[model samples]
Every structure is written in C-alpha cells, then in structure tokens.
Target: MQKMAVLLSGSGRTLDNFHSRIQEGSLAGEIQVVISNVKDVLGLQKAVNYGYPAFHAADNDEINRILADYEIDIICLAGYLKLYSPPEKLKRAVINIHPSLIPSFCGDGYYGNIVHRAVKARGCTVSGCTVHFADENYDEGPIILQKTVEVGYNDDIDTIATTVFAAECEAFPEAINRVNEMGIDFFWDRVAK
Candidate 1:
C-alpha cells in the first residue's frame, strides 16, 4: 500500500472521509501521519481518536521533517491553508482538493464557507470541487480531476457547501486512488524539466 501524509487546517472532515474510505477498503493507501497547522482543532483530535500518528506543526521546516521521517509517498492537503513548498522530488507527490473549481473561487483567502459565500454572491448556477497536484502556488497546479454540483438560486451557503462537499467525498477519494495507482514516478516524469 502507498503511504500518505495528510495536512489540514480546519475541521478535518476530509481527513474523516479518507479514514472511512480506507476502513471500507475503497482507498488503497495507508495514512502514515496527520499534521494540522492549527493546534486545538477537531481534526487533530479526530486523528488521535483514529489512532494515527498526528502532530501540530506550522513551521515549514518542521512539516518537511515530519514528512521526511514518515517516508511519505503521497501528501494530501485537506483544507490546508498554507502555501506548501515541497522539495523537487516530492513536489508532484502533494495533492490538494479545493472546495471550488480552479480559476474560480479558489486561490488565497478562499476556503470553507468563504468560497461558498463567494459563489452565492456571484450568482453562479454551478459549483464544484477540484483535486489537483499542489505546487509552489495555491490552486495553480496541474488539474487531476473535477466533479461538478448544481447550485440553485434558492440554495443558501450551508446548502451549497453541503452539496459540494458531497461531490468532494466522491471526487477526492477517486483522485487519491488514481494518483496512488499512477505512482509518484508518473508525476515526476510529467513535471520533469
């Protein structure tokens, strides 16, 4: 099984989803470690409860050390808010699932309910999720896969968020599985200079 490291900054709903998928034998990866930028969040607690090695680290050096120590094969960014600059070999190994489609309500300062609110304010009839490789920038990496959800006019932020999250529940895992199957060399070769 491929080894994975999950990094998060919020509720860790994605973390929980991955755990469920793994337990159900849908995802073919092992979560070697969990890192949360925020210390007292529910996601961190959930990791501990699930018996995964979890830690809190905001410093880039600390994060890199943890990743290196675990010998991670893939790094999944679950609602992580920081700009992660992984070393060249691991650059293509990092993945992020965004709440909104890339080139849409994504990039810095757009996350969680904030993205939903922007979608609502913009009156977009469609909103979805994007799973992509994490590069030096935010939401600017090569696209991996996307799943769309309808956005109704009457839908509130919570409702829209819930809908998109449902799509994410499916899309994120599928993306992770796809990446795992392709292996890290697939990514490295494509991005090789």
Candidate 2:
C-alpha cells in the first residue's frame, strides 16, 4: 500500500470521510499523516481522534520538514487553504481536491461553501469536483480526474456542496487507486515535473 498524507485547513469532513472509507476496507491504505494549517481547526482534533499524526504548518518550509520526517509518499490537500512551495520530494506527489470544476469558479476567494454559493448565484446547470496537481495557481493544475454533479433549478448552496462532497469521496479514492497503480515514486517524479 502507498503511504498517504492529507492536508486540511478546516473541519476536514473530507478527511473523516476518507478515514471511514479506509476503515470499511473501501479505500485500502493507511492515512499515515494529516497536516493542518491552523493548529486549532476542528479537523486537527478529528485527526487526533482517529489516531493520525496531525500538526500545524503555515508554509512550505514547515511542510517540507513534516513530510521528510514522516517519509510521506503522497500528499492530498483536502480542504487545505495554504499555498505550498513544493520541495523536490513533495513536488510531484502533491495533489489537491478543489470543490468546484475549476477554471470556472475555483481559485483565490472561492473555497468551501462559498464556491457552491457562487455557482448557485450564477445559475450554473452543473458543478462538481476537480482533483488535480497542486500548482502555483489556485485550483489550476493538470487535471487528474473530475466527477460532475447536475445542478437542479432549486438547488441551494448546501444541496450543491452535499452533492459535490459525494463526488469528492468517490474521486479521491479513485485518484488514490490510480496512484497505487502508478506506484507512488514513479509517478511522483513525472507529475512533479
């Protein structure tokens, strides 16, 4: 199994969902580590409760230290808000799950419930998640995968995020599966480049 590390900046509902999937034997691996931007985010506690090593790191230097110390192979940003300057070890292996379809309403000010709110306000007929490489640009990366959700006439922000969250759970594991097939180190160099 490939070692996985997750980064989160908020409540980490996605992380919880991933952990649950692992426990249920659907995800098929270890979380290894969880890094949070804010020390007191509720997700830090969730990681602790789940017995994963969770800590605070504000920038790339700290992240480099953390990943090196843990010998992490893959880094998935699950609601993590910080912009990371990748060290060579993490460069190719880092990925992020953006809440929107990206190049559309995802980036900078768009995150969490706000992205959904923007989509609903714009009257988008569809919106979904994009799992991609982490780049200097927000939500802009070579796309790994995406799963779109149809937006109904009456869909509210909450409804949209809920639907997108479902897609996130599925996309994350699928990405992980593809990662496993790629064999961690091999793909990291290519993707990172």
Candidate 3:
C-alpha cells in the first residue's frame, strides 16, 4: 500500500471516505499524516479521531517538512484551499480532487460551493469531479480521471455539490489505486508534457 498524506481545508467528508475505503480494504493506500490549514476544521478533527498523525500547518515549508518526515508516498488534497508547493522531489507525488470538471470552474477563488454555484449560473448540463496531479497552479495539472454527473436545469447548488461529491468519493480512490498500480513513472511522463 502507498503511504499518503492528506491535506484539507473544510469538512472531512473526503478524508472520511478515504478512511472508510481503507478500513474496507478497497483503497490501496494508508494515510500516514493529515494536515489542515485551518486549525479547527472537521478534517483535522477527523484525522485526530482516526488515530492518524495530524497537524495544523498554514506554511508551505512546514507542510513540506511534515511530508518529508513522514516519508509519504502520495499526497492527497481532499478539500485544501491553499496552494501547497511540494518539495522538488515530491512534485509528481501530489494529487488533488477538484469538485468540478477542470478548465470549467477551477482556479484561484474557485472551490466548494463557489464551484457548484458557478455551474448552476452557467446552466451546465453536467458537472463532475476531476482527480489530477497537483501542479504549482490551482487545478492545473494532468487529469488522472474524471467522473461526470448529469445536472438538471433546476438542480440547486447543494444538489449539484452532493452529486459531484458522490462522484468524488469514487474518483479519488480510483485515482489513488491507479497510481498505485501504474506507478508514478507513468504519471511522471504525463505530467512532464
């Protein structure tokens, strides 16, 4: 199993899903550490409750130190809002799950409910989650996978968010498993392009 470090800025819904999948032997990853930019968010609390090494780190240098200390194999950004600059050696090891189809509603200032609201405002017929390598920019990395969810004209932001999150729960683990099976070398080539 690959060792993972999870970073989040909101509720622990994605972290919770990872825990559930790991417990059920579905995901081929072990969460080594959990870090949150916000000190008191549900994600940090859930990490502590799960008995994983958890911390509050708002500085990118501190985050990099923790990742190095833990010897993390994969870094997963569950709902992290901050931009994390991974160390040179770990550039290809970071992954993130964006709540919308990338290139649509992703970048600085676009996340969570904001993304959902944008989709609604645009009258998008479909919304989904994108699991991709985390580059220096926000949501601008090589996509590993994307799962689409049909959106009705009347679907509210909350409804759209819920639908996309369900797809996210499946997509994140699938991406992690794919990385585990295919190896980072495969992604290294893709990300280099």
TM-score of each: 0.93, 0.89, 0.96
In order, candidate lDDTs are: 0.88, 0.83, 0.91
lDDT score of residue 5 within candidate 2:
86
How much does each candidate deviate from the true structure in C-alpha RMSD? 2.0, 2.5, 1.2
Predicted structure 2, TM vs. truth: 0.89
lDDT, candidate 2, 49-111, per-residue tens: 999998898877887788887766678888888787667856767788888887788888888
List, residue by residue over 73-182, the lDDT tens digit for candidate 1: 88899988899877566877888999998889988888889999999999999999999888877888877789999999899999999999999999988988888777
Which ten-residue region of model 1 has the weakest summed lDDT?
184-193
Q: How many backbone clashes does every candidate have?
A: 0, 1, 0
Order of quality (lDDT): 3, 1, 2
Per-residue error (Å), model 1, residue 136? 0.9
Best candidate according to TM-score: 3
lDDT measured at residue 101 in model 1 versus the true structure, 0 to 100: 87
| Candidate 3: regions farther than 4 A off | none
Index of the highest-lDDT prediction:
3
TM-score, candidate 1, is 0.93
Model 1 misplaced stretches (Cα beyond 4 Å): 184-193
